[model samples]
Target: MEIREIFAHNLRALRKTKGLSQEELAHEAGLDRTYISSLERQIYGASIDVVDRIAKGLAVEAADLLRCPEAEATK
Candidate 1:
């Protein structure tokens, strides 16, 4: 999958795992709810700064958001 797809999938999974709604994650990330929805829906690509902000919001490493799902399955 593409990087954008990986990031989107990871973001959604992580957000759900943390019991956060899109609005909540957006708040935690200091971003707008629509922007968060756009990211999750793959309507926009996240820059490095945004990735860092999201990682911080999720309390995870930025790399975690970029990991390929198939690769993660083996670990």
Candidate 2:
């Protein structure tokens, strides 16, 4: 998979772990629901600022949004 796909996967996992729906997460992150959906689907790329906002909203470090923990194991 591409790096973007891996990021989307990690984001999805983290969101689920936090028990947040896409809409809820979008609202909390000050993003649009469609945009959030696109991000989760790897259809849209996120800027660093956007990632920071999402990480902050989810109470995670910014690296948590950009880094793939499982991918590290696979590598």
Candidate 3:
């Protein structure tokens, strides 16, 4: 998979593990629910600023949001 796809898949996995819905995660990430859904579906590449926001909202380090073969979020 592409780096973006890995990141998106990992993001969705993390959110589910936290027992949060797309709406809840988006709210926490200061984003729109559709946006999160789109991201998880790998419809777009998230910017660094948005990734930072998502990391903070998820209470995780920014590095934790990156995917492997890149930064190391996804396996």
Candidate 4:
């Protein structure tokens, strides 16, 4: 899968795991709700700085967000 898609999947999974809604995650990440929604839908590509902000909001390492379990296992 594409990196953006992987990131979107991971972001949604993590956000749900943390029991946070898109609005709540956006608020915590200092981003707009629609932007967060777009990111989760793989409609937006985030910069490294934005990735860091998202990781901080999810309370996870930036690397964790980029790690795709299935892909990583193959590598």
Candidate 5:
């Protein structure tokens, strides 16, 4: 998968695992709910700062959100 796709997939999984809706995550991250949805959909690229904010909101390391499953298989 593309890096953006990986980010989107991981983001969705993490959000679900945390039992948080997009709106809740957005609120926690101090971002707009629509922006969160757009990120989850891979409709836009996220800056490093935004990624950090998302990771903080999810209580996880930023790198965790960037992990790509396909890249792991190539390892």
Candidate 6:
């Protein structure tokens, strides 16, 4: 899958795992809720700064948001 898809998938999964709604995550990340929704839907690409902000919101490493789910399944 493409990197955008990977990021979207991981972002959604991590957000759910943390029991956070899109709005909640967006608030924590200091972003708009629609922007967070767009990212989760793969409608927009996140910049390095946005990724860092999101990672901080999720309390995870930025790399975690970019990890390929298929690769993880093989591990």
Top candidate, metric TM-score:
6
Q: Give the Å shift of residue 6 in candidate 1.
A: 0.3
Worst 10 residues of 6 by lDDT: 36-45
Determine which window of 10 residues in candidate 5 has minimal summed lDDT: 65-74
Model 2 per-residue lDDT tens digits across residues 1-75: 676787688788899999999899999999898888898888977888988888877899988777767777899
Query: What is candidate 1's TM-score against the reference?
Result: 0.95
lDDT of 5 at 37: 94
The per-model lDDT (C-alpha) reads: 0.94, 0.84, 0.82, 0.92, 0.93, 0.95
Model 4 scores a C-alpha lDDT of 0.92
How displaced is residue 38 in candidate 2, in Å? 0.1
Instruction: Give one digit per residue, the lDDT tens place, for model 1 in 1-75.
Output: 988899999999999999999999999999999998899899988999999999999999999999899897989
Q: Point out where model 2 deviates above 4 Å.
A: 72-75
lDDT of 1 at 16: 97
Candidate 4 per-residue lDDT, tens place, 1-75, comes to: 889989998999999999999999999999999999999888878998999999999999999999886877799
Q: Candidate 3 clash total?
A: 0
Model 3 lDDT, full chain set: 0.82
Local error of candidate 3 at residue 56 (angstroms): 1.1
Tens-digit per-residue lDDT, 1-75, candidate 3:
687877797788778878889898889988999999899988989998988988877888777767554454354
lDDT, model 4, position 60: 99
Residue 20 miss distance in model 1 (angstroms):
0.4
- Per-candidate TM vs. native? 0.95, 0.86, 0.84, 0.91, 0.91, 0.97
Q: Judging by lDDT against the true structure, name the best candidate.
A: 6
Model 6: per-residue Cα lDDT over 1-75, one tens digit each: 999999999999999999999999999999999999999889988999999999999999999999899999999
